[model samples]
Target: MRFLSSLLLAALIVEQVLGEYGMAHFSDWGNSKGKDYCIFFNSQWARLPQDLSKATRLQTYDLTSSVLCSPSDVPEGGFPNSIPMVMRGNCTFYEKVRLAQINGAKGLLIVSKDRLTPPSGNKSQYEEIGIPVALLSYKDMLDISKTFGEKRQVAMYAPNEPVVDYNMVLIFLMAVGTVALGGYWAGSRDIKKRYMKHKRDDGAEKQDEETVDVTPIMICVFVVMCCSMLVLLYFFYDQLVYMTIATFCLASAVSLYSCLWPFVRRIPFGKCRIPENNLPYCHKRPQVRMLILSAFCIGVSVTWGVFRNEDQWAWILQDALGIAFCLYMLKTIRLPTFKACTLLLVVLFVYDVFFVFITPLLTKSGESIMVEVAAGPSDSSTHEKLPMVLKVPRLNSSPLVLCDRPFSLLGFGDILVPGLLVAYCHRFDILMQTSQIYFLACTIGYGIGLLITFVALTLMQMGQPALLYLVPCTLLTSLAVALWRKELPLFWTGSGFVPPPIIMEQINCTQTPGPSTDEPPSNPEPATSETNNQREDPTPATQEEVPHLTDASNT
Candidate 1:
């Protein structure tokens, strides 16, 4: 066990070191190096003729102007005498797009050094870019530049392409695969089974001796729910159409009725036990305390939501207290249960802090202040255009400058609250707490919170616009509450109140002794009058002696 723990520690250290290095070299999503600007074209000109109809005739001066001109000798304007353009060699298209935006460039053109393989279809086309973008061959560039001397202006067209980082996408895929493989390996190991065995009661039966008929029933339930959601969409088309459809798909794909899932285990297949007596067998102080701390973090997040920037100092104070608590916990983790808690703490701290700080430094430089001023009024008000706070890098250009970015406690609070809640639910099976009335109430609250956080965080990660993201989160939370109301009674009556029965039959049947060899003694006769007076009973007759058998062992 010690050796295994040491191995795991070593692996974690290695992983962390690699992760840090990866972050330093790549963007937040593990894309190519995120340098400031691409400045391939001037902001004054209409962006790279996305559509021929929208194209404005480029003026002689605007034809070769640049917003963020680097002192590079790269040819520009597709003309031999064209102006010098600053071209960023980011390894991913997404970074190129972002860099173009930061530099206030009118257009971006990405060229590959290797042979270009155009995407087969434009199903996932980019709807819009802050600036237009195009892909061209090196030879095409040369030919176009040679004509530039004659025409002095060339009509180049760019398509509406969704600029996604294929490399980042590949990394995401690999990480997911690695996690799945690790999970499978861990599941196949003996440790979990041994842990479950040790945790079982001394005498209990197997969990699933009888065949269950849950499949068809579950399928029917799913069908009914999906149909109901469809009806909701039909009736409340304007209000609920999108939400209803999303819910239906989620239920269909994620529910147990689905044919098979690679990552998710079958809900009813595992033999989790409900203790007959309220012994709190698996409950440990660290586990319970972790739950409490997670809940507190959520509460803080909620409080932050209610009072966005008003309680900044209070939030800071609370964080300090939390740090102190962590110090206390460091000492308390001498026991095994707290060891897992320690790991959880370390992970949460590192992941949150890393992203919070790194995002700013990795981002490209913003457009010039005068340029933003020169642009005409946008549909949004000035305040709307400005991020709640203006984040600027410190004069000291260390990685620590990321921390100097203007802080938004609310944003951090929202992310942390949900993530920690999810971890809490997973660690303790809080969803299974509906058995007792007190626990049921706790579950209802926690479940609602969990649903909200799940939807909110998922939407945040999915690139939804900031203003609209909260709606989905709120709606999901309300839906969860309604579902809990409907299921509470059933939960209380059936399996909810009864702890899952622990299986202990395996323990009793684990090992056997060698066959016995001692012979049976002669059986004594029934008690006589003297024996009765002596108050003693005769020896019970052996099974072989009593039964009409050739040879048999005694009972």
Candidate 2:
């Protein structure tokens, strides 16, 4: 599933027919007080005036003839000051509203069983009607009928939804902190890479060796996979959600182990290894503490999977694991140069925009494929959601909750795509001795980009392709820093600061023929390509020595 920014996740969950949300305050006219259930008011009709003093009286039309097409269906004197609830279908919304209005109904509540849409009407029809029109789901209608038999009063008023939810603050902190910390960690490790190499023994050495430096070719293939996987999930969500969950469980467990290994190694007590055995991969004497840590990480992921639906506390665990996963990826997947970083980030940028924006047109539901899959398919039988995103519950109570989207989401890709670049900057700074300037600039750029994304989210009210903003800001800021410091050439290629090769001097000496002290006379050593090596260490003669000096360039 795509990890996406879902500030207006309401687009998918809350289909605001008129781009407005209202709470259907249904109550007994006699009792005078009751619960308010959320409902949508159509923009085509008279908009609710937000004055609770004018509640429409609720009356159900005859069930058998629920379309209420005929004036005969109107009760004796008609619904004098009431709004009649009618079942959807069999007639146009305008026809239903007009018939209800002429029969003395104050408004119309069209109970719909399908997706919510506007009680649409032409401009001419708009002037011919005087009552409000709204949609109430069949489920809400049944609840109202069962809760209070009849004589119900309902008010439809749109409340101003708070554009800024407190959850945004939490999301900001989490996103910024995770990206910054990962960058700093990557840079620091790079600065001490040589020292670390000397200090690390068996397990740590293996861990260091496992990190894969990103390459230009690897990057293209990776983006293609991201696109393919996202599409597959969108199409086969039911079939793949299980595999996604299981993959996450396994992957997160390994990532968490990698993240924790540094700290675990310091424990000293767990450094002891088990005796050798022929039991498959572990036959090479594995560390006992490593095994224990592995089990704990696996346990956490499985626990999250089991209680994945527990909205109360499960999100905390998921976010914690997700952050570790991001950090682990930052460390393990090395970006070898600024060129590779640019290629990876830019390619993924296009990938995210295509999936999130362009796919809506291609989708039958008119919902973006990234958003549809990210939110979980509406028709899935399992109701299982992918746990790859960072989700935080909305901290305020608003009418928006009626949409069932109480959480704001940021996908792992959003964090990781930029994070990988930031990690490269840190390594760049440390290696080039630039005082972390590149790292800081890119990280700050990322934070600023995220801020812009949230702003777009608030104003536009839709899921945004985060990488669109993140890539430009990060890549440009880093490029600017390189230009300002006059290190663009070195930074772009990742050369200058790398340790010099010990054997290169010998090779150079052999290639360059200095003015001959003994005179290139005698036999001119004429044709001796082997004299290049003897020119340096003049005492070589033994077999091992013979191999060393003879064509040492090739050796």
Candidate 1, which segments miss by more than 4 Å at Cα? Answer: 1-50, 57-143, 146-149, 155-158, 162-178, 190-515, 519-555
lDDT of 1: 0.28
Error of 1 at 28 (Å): 41
**Candidate RMSDs in order:** 23.1, 8.2
TM-score of each: 0.26, 0.74
For residues 1-555, what per-residue lDDT tens digits would candidate 2 score against the true structure?
122212111112211111345767777776667777766666557877564556553644433337676666666877667777877887778888898898788878888776454576667898898888877777887788889755667777666667788888898899889999987887677546633444657553366524566777877666666666777777898898887777776667776887888788789797788887998757867788978988899899889888888988999988988888778776666777788888887887787788777987787656777776766765567777777778888788776577446688777777877887898888777666677889889989999999888888878766788888889999999999999999888778765453344644565465545676555535535435565665556454232222211121322
Choose the strongest candidate by lDDT.
Answer: 2
Q: CA lDDT of each candidate? A: 0.28, 0.71
Task: Give per-residue lDDT, candidate 2, residue 3.
Answer: 23
Runs in model 2 lying further than 4 Å from the true structure: 1-21, 30-32, 40-143, 190-205, 271-282, 399-403, 498-555
Error of 1 at 494 (Å): 27
Cα lDDT tens digits, model 1, 262-380, are: 22222334334433454543332223332333445445444433343343354443333222222221211111121222233334334334333343344342221111211211111
